[model samples]
Target: MDKENARNTTIFLVCMVALLVFYEIFVIGPREKQRQAQQHAVAAQQQAVAAAAPGAATYVNRAQALAGSPRVQIDTPALQGSVALKGGRLDDLFLKGYRQGLAKDSPPVELFRPEGAKQAYFAESTWVGPALTPGPLTQWTLASGTVLSPGHPIGLTWSNGAGLDFARTIAVDDHYMFTVSDQVTNHGTAPIKLAPYASVQRQGEPELSKTNIIHEGAVGSLGGQLRLIAFKPWKKQGDTTFTSTGGWLGITDKYWLAAIVPDQTAQVKAQFRVDTVNGVNVYEADDVGAIRTLAPGATTTSNTRIFAGAKKVSVLANYEKTLGVPHFDDAVDWGHFWFLTRPIFWLLETIHGYVGNFGIAILLLTVVLRGLMFPFANKSYESMSKMKKLAPEIDIIKKRNDKDPAKVQQETMALYQREKINPLMGCLPVLVQIPIFFSLYKVLYVSLEMRHAPFFGWVQDLSARDPTSFVNLFGLLPFSPASVPMIGGILDGPLHIGVYPILYAATMWLSTAMSSQSITDPTQKMVSQLMPVMLLYFFASTPAGLVVYWVASNLFTVGQQYIIMRRFKVDNPIDSLIAKLRGARTPSAAAG
Candidate 1:
């Protein structure tokens, strides 16, 4: 048994090392190279854009881009930016409620930048057709209202020399939605055909989370079905079109979204496409309504709404409910388990309302979930405690049938049946936890509410990885270990385990060790012993909030198991350690 256990441990260690090496080579290295290449390409593109322009700045910043455009200021309770009057484009925007970082003076979260900017992203609604229609460089003139706000609406007008006059009225809510109403009146002798079109365009790719859990690219709901194409896939496809009535399309980041919503009752043709401009990839999501012929002395109007801001669940749900934006809440990336994830988010948000802290809310949410699953957990722990009590009998059976594995298994089954204990019962709690774990993970990863949320000491951003690294001695060291030259990447990547991850691993070890004490099989016992260590490495880079949940859950499970084991008078790790400590103390007391 000793030889077999040692061999299994050696094999396991070798496999783990091999897996890590393979992952580092194939996954991390390529991703890092690709990211660096993208950054360099974007910088080169910006330099080229600046060079190509006549006497433009060497590198155009956001302020420079905003100054380049003739604009109308956008001021609202939730947003602050401007409308580029050159195309009447909703181009420059920043979320007032969110910041780029947790610093007290960090800039607000920028949602849009104008065409001349490094990462130009904007939304525009216009008329398109046979007759001269308003285009991006149409040079619109503001015809009404000054600052665009919740109550104030602005009007922009442009007239083609061919006698087609276009008028657009832009209005915004206190939140993220912008209503663009376009009217075109033909003043020519002949009738003209025109169609309403709306587009959300992005010039270059922004830094993405690159995680599979949360989607960050072109997302839409067409014909009441959700469609998602990630950035790489979106680039590869080049162009994707859908014909549907009452749907929305947009580009989404993990927490931000820029979407165009056509009239819910209107039949529209929408397309998600990517174009390379001067060697830079430009992604666009656009929709156009059916062409309508305007007779002489005829006036037609079209209304389209654009959503550009943080993906707040309440805001998206309100728009979906009140404005009939189909699947607007899908912008949050609820994943395959939306039923559970959405409810979990709602519960977390609800709890947060009362507690006034998302960290506390997460703790309370875990407690509630565990309480709901208490019956199953109770049964599982009871069965485990009972099995621990039968360890001696099982050991005896194994030793008696040492050479015959079938006889050992048969006797073990017989023993379990006699004890009225189901050996598989322990798996029930773990199985139940899988979906809940994934759901809560999704909530923490994707929900805007969890972003920049704080837990207790050292966790300022729940959505981000734990900032306290063991390599830096949990921030007590003056110098950052990750800042070292040669092995910095390694230190920052895998070896940068954090306090929460360590706590979680320790709790998991305790729970797993307690459970494994009853296992007589060498391989199974070895696997159980290594499970917590593997999980510690795996979860080292996950969000601090998720680690908090796992630690809390493990501690709760340990407490439950301890109580059940004590009640059953089963030998467990806690009691064993306590008895050993007392034995050591007894010798010292006798010596004294």
Candidate 2:
């Protein structure tokens, strides 16, 4: 009967695994393939547009895109791009320092693409009123400098046929901020009502690494509140409106940002909107400034700013302090544990500043954190050591109360009280570190400063998954197992635990082995032995830096337990094994 039941359970488990594999292969696979096909079709269409408008910047190349429209060049310390004269939009922007990859010849990161281009993204400013106003395709004459630069600004001028004249002055500093001063004069007989508006828009869902832990979509700080809406949520709602004073809104990628900031003192309306344009998903983060009435011969000016480039933490915090852009630093998704996450970033940043390596910084951070929690860990380990020394007594107590589980537990509690060793003390240390562990992961995953930051050999980018894998013989094999047939994704994804993760696993197993010595139950022992393997898979896909941190933390734990157990005079298996080997070698040396 037992054999038959075991066979039945095995069959059920096998069937469930097969069903999951089939569901993934059929149901999930087809939908992903369809999405990719649609993306390819869109790319092909854009390529056709590029062919029609040869050498146009919107076609493919940034230079050609710049040539497609009359524009003023944007030259600054960190950004290189152009402002289109038509519609007076800030269309093209490239981060001069950041590259698309680690290679020397890789293209610089392109933050903004021009209109009519694939994944077209740009920022525009306009006046909204009852009558016809300057819209897309409206020609605006360049009235001032040939380029937009610090100490030099560009002015654009246009007039509606009804005698309302408009002019906008655009300027940029040494960094990412672009200030726009919009002026309008009503020359007609009747007064005209107008509102200044700005929008940062993308014609399609620009490729996103949609990691749920780190936000990678619409981000805004309005009414002193920070709002993050990911792609899936934005697609469902289509549009969201917020009324706030002295705030800004924008579309954000993981490392790059393009936001429109109204005057710090002005009350404004902001909306995050999405729509299907030309069969492509278009998303926009727009803000409308105060509405003003321009009497005949009256000119009113509205001033605002744009941030378009890498979201460097220091630069953003500086902008927040100087420009008083409330909570501008909140743009970097600090997660729910902002209190802990922010300080962790600051500490890591400070240590990296001194140590000159992120990996070393992580090690030092682990040391500091363990030192901070030394009291709690000492208590836990001391209690555990007491438990280890009391294991014989515990066994006797259990055997005496073997018939009643509740009586055994009650006796165990009484024994713990008499011996002044709390079994529950072990859990307190883990609870405290849980939030810290998650915060460190969030910093590694979201903070732009860590993007592409190198550690040591084999870790050129700490924010990326570990590169070496056993299936590829840690890169000794010329090709990838991912190129294999039918089961490539499974092998390449879940089964891709690499070198650092293995180190993490080893440390975890050693630590767990040392700690699990006193837990003699067969079932509990099995669970403890399997825990490190489960953790290896759990942490396999996390950033390499996070893994390094975990390994360092595990080592610190091992070090702490060694010290505390020795202090308590408890038996340590590692020390016992080492002493036994030493004792074996002593006799051989004397005989020789």
Candidate 3:
């Protein structure tokens, strides 16, 4: 029966792998062509819209485009970009500390692209009223400092023909916050009502990911409630609006964010709308301040802020506390496991702060986790050890009632109860470790800090799959193994493992073998043996940083198990395995 079950399991795994291979070839292979065609249509529509704007030229090189426009240079420790003088728009920004790769000369990560670009994303502000005529392209005259960098506020002034004096002051901080103060003095004979409004809009969806594990589109919070508006599902949701006394709404990319923050103490209207413009998808999030009527010689001012930059956890948390932006730190893709992911991130970051190297921090975190779980794990393993020592008696009981199944079961239960052994206790450690493992994986996948970060030796770019492939002898050979036939892609997908994954496999296998004695059921033992090989392929395509964490975790687990086993004088499989191999080779050695 055990042999039959093993055969069936192997067949199931093979069938699953075959199905995946077929799906990759027949389904995933054709989507690229359709995606490209859609992108071209979106670009053509955007060009038409740009033709009507002030700068009719389509977006070009970021440097050249920035130079073409009258601008106020933005210089901060965390941001380097420009504020367009034409419309007083906050665009053309790059994350100063993030780069395209590990190379020093690699360009900084460009966060905001201009309106005429291939995938235009930016933020704009304006006044909305019956008498207001200020549009997105309205040009304002610079009335203050030339540069709008950190700690420096710049002002712009414009007077409509209708007797309204419009003044705008833009101020940015050392981080990602931008405070905009707008004042309008009513000089007309009659009173006019107006409301301040801000918007963050992106032209077309930016290649919506196929996976739903991470949100990659418009997201916001209103009335202390969080909302995630997926790009693909926006058409179904259609123009969702929320009214709150004070909250923020904005679009969020995987690692960066741009949120419209209204005064937390005042009432505002926030909306997420999808508009089709000339066959292009325009996803936008906007907030409008409450209407206020200004009489002649009366002045009205509205203060609002925007957060536009990398979604660093600490920075977002600080902003939420100081600025009262609701759940701002939730912008980072913590997935559904935020409960576990948040604490794990805080602990990992705290360790990294002291160690100064993220790789080293992961290792220390593994040790700390093992130490914390030591009490429960100790009890579980001790129970398993007692069961292992009772194996001989259990086998005797089985043989004594070989002809009577119920008698055998009764004897085994009696023996188990006499020894106070509970088989369920053995599974407790695995259950406890599952969430920690997943949460760590979440942190490594979505956090920007892990991108392009380096470990010692050749392990650069922790957020990417390991580039080294042992099939080419890890680049020891001049030729590429991918040149081989038939199963090359498969080899490259699950078998193209790096040194870190190999280390992970080794540690996991060692830990599994150490606990082999507890898996006395032949079926369980067989599955345990197969689990390590399956894990090697499973982890092969995961980020290198995650593999590092797994390897460290397994190593700590192995050490902890070893200590407990040694203390209780339990048998270890490493020695038993060696002895069995030696015995099997004895006849051949004697013959030689």
Top candidate when judged by lDDT against the true structure: 1
Q: Which parts of model 3 are misplaced by more than 4 Å?
A: 1-68, 208-211, 479-491, 577-592
Model 1 TM-score, 2 decimals: 0.93
Q: Residue 216 in candidate 3 has what lDDT?
A: 80
Cα lDDT of model 3 by residue, 1-592, tens digit:
3323434664465456556645544455346445668778866866777777764444566566566568887888888888887777887889988886778999998878776555678887878999865776777888998788877899989888899999999999999999999889998999999998999998767765444557887787787778887887876678998898887888887788998888889898889999876555788999898888899999988888988999888899899898888888888878788899988888988998998888898888888888888888888888777777888887898788889867876777677788897766766787798888888888888887787777787888777777888998898987665676976655565567878888888998898887767765676676676667667765777788889888887887777777777787888865677889999999999999
| Span of 10 residues, lowest total lDDT, candidate 2 | 1-10
- The collision pairs in model 2 are 56-64, 56-65, 57-64, 57-65, 58-65
TM-scores, in order shown? 0.93, 0.89, 0.87
Tens-place lDDT per residue, model 1, 491-566, is 7876778999999989999999988766666776777787777777767878898998889999899999999999
lDDT of 3: 0.80
Error of 3 at 513 (Å): 2.0
Tens-place lDDT per residue, model 2, 43-158, is: 88766764576553243555666677887888888989888887789888899989999888999899888886667899988889896888888889999998788889989999
Which wins on TM-score, candidate 1 or candidate 3?
1
Superposed by TM-score, candidate 3 places the C-alpha of residue 419 at a distance from the truth, in angstroms, of 1.0
- State the C-alpha lDDT per candidate: 0.88, 0.84, 0.80
> Any idea what lDDT model 2 has?
0.84
The RMSD of every model to the true structure, in order and in angstroms, is: 3.5, 5.5, 4.6
When 1 and 2 are scored with lDDT, the better candidate is 1
